[model samples]
Target chain A: MKGRILEVARRIFGQYGFHGTTTRMIAQEVGIDISTLYYHWGEKGDLYEAVVLDIYEDLREQLFEVEKRIHGLPLDKRMEIAVEMMTDYLFERPEISNLTLFRYFAKTRHASPLDFRVPEIMGNIAHSMGLVSDKKQLPPDAKMKMLAVMNAIHNFVSGQNFFLTMLDMDEKEYVKGVKETLKFLIIPAFVHNGATTKRA
Target chain B: MKGRILEVARRIFGQYGFHGTTTRMIAQEVGIDISTLYYHWGEKGDLYEAVVLDIYEDLREQLFEVEKRIHGLPLDKRMEIAVEMMTDYLFERPEISNLTLFRYFAKTRHASPLDFRVPEIMGNIAHSMGLVSDKKQLPPDAKMKMLAVMNAIHNFVSGQNFFLTMLDMDEKEYVKGVKETLKFLIIPAFVHNGATTKRA
Candidate 1:
């Protein structure tokens, strides 16, 4: 019962966001009493915190798997795998992008304990991709580069309806194209950067 | 009075989005009565539509100027100038991205006459960048490429708060870094593509 509630909460929060969603809505969707939801989750913010943490954990897991595979590959190869793996993970659960984008643009951010942990995650990615030597003090350029990669993935997922219509593509083609385009655009640049740095 | 109200509406709508925003809020911010606001624009949706149209017009004007300047330039050079100019334009008025993202993710998209005109815009842009020759029946790949570029720019602007915090970059640095990063990633990929096609 607890697991099911959490799953529903994740989807609902992703759809309407924290402000747009109400405990009543979640409970109604779960076909349970609102008080029952409170009994399990405590409060709306608490449930939201759980959802954010869940997403973070999932992202970390995906990053770990990606890191394990691309640990010692060339920079371009690492980026190719990372972009493919991350885009796949995010696309499967696009709610993650939806919720994150909502959090960014939300007018009044609800007070919550769990946040995106963006820097920590970016640091891990920068280090893993061989862009930064230290996660503790990632360079602005490295972080910025990671930002470019991440922003592309998140936007492609979040803006699906708009992008699909604009591109006249089905969902399947959109996914394939997103991965191809990211590689075509990102890999060579970073590979060139890697080469330039080695020469420098 | 009407013009002032539209300006206020654009900002508020960008901030709170269409669903989250209300005529009352706009009136409050504009320091006018609700009746006065309605007198200028029929209702909430009417004013929102006006704002969308206004943004589209601004984009068209910018595109025309971009075309005039980069008409006969190389594809890579065209992309560089376009990215620089468009990023500058969008950053100055981020509400355009905000509202567009909002509209895409918006549940129960409000009924409005003025729409994004995404295909038309993309075709014009793709042609200008030498990705496609026709504004009509844009090839799937061509549209996808344009989507990649547009998605990168929109995400960078829309996710500014989240991205800036993660990157630990000041606003000025963030803007400069974004432009640089886009050029670094996009210019080379397209340039290579252009070069390959020329050889073929």
Candidate 2:
């Protein structure tokens, strides 16, 4: 029952948006009574939070595992893993990708706007940056530069229009382009700086 | 009267979204009859299109003027103009900015999506790349790389979440960061490759 509710909720919410979606509609889609929904999730707001949180937790698990694998990889390799991990994670659940990053962020009146926390996502970024910082490879300024580049790529993939348009690239080609971006455009500036700033 | 209608339309459509907004509400807000609105703009869809198109045209003009002023300037100077142009264009009418980029982009059942038909936006990007292509003196592949970097910056600025959270930096500082990112991360790669190819 819980899984059914979630499946229906994801589809409806993705199609109609959070504001347009109503609990009754979700209940109807789930083929359950309204009382049953309240009994399970307490209320509509609670249900919405749960649905959003589930995606975050799933994303968190994936990101954490990637972080673990690259625990002590060098700076460039770590960045490459980070980019690939983010792209793969987002692609796995495009609906969740759209909901979390695009739909909610685009809205003027977001539910629980003040408390819309994604600490796990931030943790992954900070962890990635830590790997670079610990390498003592880049200059002091390179950490922020690396973070900015990663953010730009993440934002691009999270965008629906851009991601859809990029369907031209096969998975291998896509990953290749991503690595090429990180390699040629991103890595060198920090690499040289890292060598010089080893002490600092 | 037309200007008054547009002002009310911007606010109303923003809150209710394009599909949710109506000619009646616009007319009521402007103290005019529904018939008066149709007399002026023919239909609700026509009026909505006009509202969004006007904003797009305004932005195009603002970008064009900035590009003209920055002609033959250094890469950094041209970047500064691009940032200033985006800041001024969005800040002058943040409502229109949100409506055009965010609200209109949202897929709705009944509403036609915003089609910003102005070709100059792409032209400006191509021309900017042309200038940087000379500076970098790279082959065609490097030029494509330069375009991607600029596109990433464009997406970053136009993105709603980035704008909302970036309150720490004033427009000028934020623009400076973009310029620096372009200069350090992007221009250098192109220049490096271009130099390599030239030597080869």
Candidate 3:
């Protein structure tokens, strides 16, 4: 029961955001009374925090997996795999990008102390792309470059409703186009700039 | 008074969006009563529509300027000019990207039957980039490619609030990084793909 509520909360919150969602709506969706919701989650703020933390933790795990899978790979290959895996993961659950972007731009009065852990995950990505030697001391330009890459991916996933219509393709084709475009745009820049080029 | 209200409406709407904003708040910020707001702008929906059209017109004008400036230039030079101009325009008034992304993802119950005029603009960009011969019938790949570039620009501008913090830089540096990163990532793909290589 508790897990069900959290799942629904994630979806609802991802769609509507903290400013747009309410405990009442979550309860109605879950077929539970407000009291039951309160009993399990305590308050709307707590529930929102839980949802954010849940998303952050999931992103961390996915990044870790990508890091491991791309371990010891060339720069181009690592970016190819990283972009594909991350885009697929986020597209499958677009609510993740929805929520991630919401948190990125929205200045809610109820802003939480938590973030998506952008700096930490950014370092991980920088490390994966061979853009930096140490994750802790990520260069400002590296962070900015990573932001450009990460921002494009998040926008592509979240703005699908708009882009999908503009292109007039089905979701599969849309996803394929996105993966191809990302790979095309990112690979040459990163691989060409680094001395440790794609010898693979 | 009316123009002031519209300006405030643009900013507020860009920040909070149509769903998150209210006439009461707008009126309060404008130092006018709700009645005056309605008198000038009709219902909230009418005002919101006005805001959308206003932005669309501004974008059309700016795009026209970019197109005229880049005419007959080589691919790389045209791309450089376009990215710098568009990024600067959007960054100056980030509410544009803010409201845009909000409309993209927010499934607001009051979603207006209007959009940011995406297909039309995509065609304009494609034609300028030499990706499509005719603007009226853009290829799917062309539209998709254009979306990737536009999405990156919008994301960098809109997500600047989050990104600026992560990079620990002021807005000027952040904007420069975004433009450089954009040029670095995009120029290679489009120019290399096309037969009209940069001889300049």
Candidate 4:
């Protein structure tokens, strides 16, 4: 029942957002009483936080695993692996992408607990891809370039259903096109730039 | 009063989405009676449609004007002007960006009324940039590449507040960075590629 509640909560929160969702709604969806939800998650805030953290942690783990697998490849190859892994992960679990955007808008007035951790995680991944080196802070231009790449991939995966429908294309074809476009955009933006050339 | 209702409706609908908001809420926000809202806009759906159409018309006019201003420029220069104009428009009026994404998710089951019109407008703009010659259908690869570029710029503008906060950067500095990054990504992807090389 506890696990079931979390699963339902994730979907509900992703759809309706924090303010739009209620504990009662989550309890009803989970086929449990309100008290049972509180017993497991403590409060509405707690439940929301748990769902966001779980999604982030899962993504962090996946990125780390990809990093490990591509540890010694050339920079271009490493980026290819990272983009492929990320695109697949995001496509399969679009709720994470939606939830990330939801949290961004919903909590902009206050600092997000995940704010510091996200840059760190993304920084580490970029380091592994040889876009950044150890013992130095990421420069502004590099940061903007990486952010653009991340935004492109994030929107592409999240907006897949919309774009596929808008463009009247098949799923297989659209995904293939996305991969090709990413290769064209990411390689020149990150790898070919003189500042972040592939490391030896 | 009718114009006031539409303006308020645009902001509220953009923030809360179609279902998330209510006519009563708009009435209260606009400081008018419920009957007044009904008098101006027949129903919630009618009001929503009006908002969507108004936004699309405004964007169309802006794009056309940009086409006029950049007439006869090099393909790269023309693209730079179009992107800069779009980035400024979206950033200043983020509600359009939010509402665009909202409509995508909210109405994916059916074809949007703007479906045919949007492509024609974008195609015209692309033609003006010399991406496609007159009296030719946009090829699939070029279409996908343009869509990717559009998505990147849209997401970058829409996610501005979230990203500025996340990166802890100044607003002016961030917007400038976005333009530079767009130039880096857009030039190589669209202009330097063999298929869409500038016309003689």
Candidate with top TM-score is: 3
In order of lDDT, best first, we have: 3, 1, 4, 2
Give DockQ per model, in order: 0.57, 0.25, 0.65, 0.38
**What would the per-residue lDDT of candidate 4 be over residues B1-200, giving only the tens digit for each residue?**
99999989888887666655778989999999999999889977788889988887777787778778788887778888988988898888777877776654443222335443666756766665567775247666566676677767777777787778767789999899889888887776566663345343
* Model 2 stretches with alpha carbons more than 4 Å out: A22-39, A42-44, A103-105, A108-114, A129-151, A158-185, A188-199, B11-47, B95-105, B111-120, B131-200
Among the candidates, what TM-score does chain A have in each? 0.90, 0.66, 0.91, 0.84
Better of 1 and 4 by lDDT: 1
Instruction: Look at candidate 4 and give me any clashing residue pairs.
Output: none
The residue-by-residue lDDT of candidate 1 on B81-187, one tens digit each, is: 99998899899888888877776665633345555677777777776676666667777766767777876787788778777776777899999999988898888
DockQ of candidate model 3: 0.65
Per-residue lDDT over A1-200 for candidate 3, one digit per residue giving the tens place of the 0 to 100 score: 89999999999988887777878889999999989999998978888889888887788788888888988887778899999998998888777888888877776654567755678988887876667768888778777778778767887888887777767888889899999888877887777754443222
Report the number of the highest-lDDT candidate: 3
Q: How well is candidate 4 docked (DockQ)?
A: 0.38
* Residue B141 Cα positional deviation in candidate 2, in Å, after optimal superposition: 8.0
A1-200: candidate 4 lDDT, tens digit per residue: 77899899987786666655778988999888899999998967778888988888877788778778788888778888888888888888776777776654433223335533677666766675567676147666666676677667767676777778766789998888888888887766555663344343
Model 2 TM-score (B-chain only): 0.63
Candidate 4 displacement at residue A183 in angstroms: 1.6
Runs in model 1 lying further than 4 Å from the true structure: A109-116, A198-200, B109-115, B198-200
Judged by DockQ cut-offs, the docking class of candidate 3 is medium
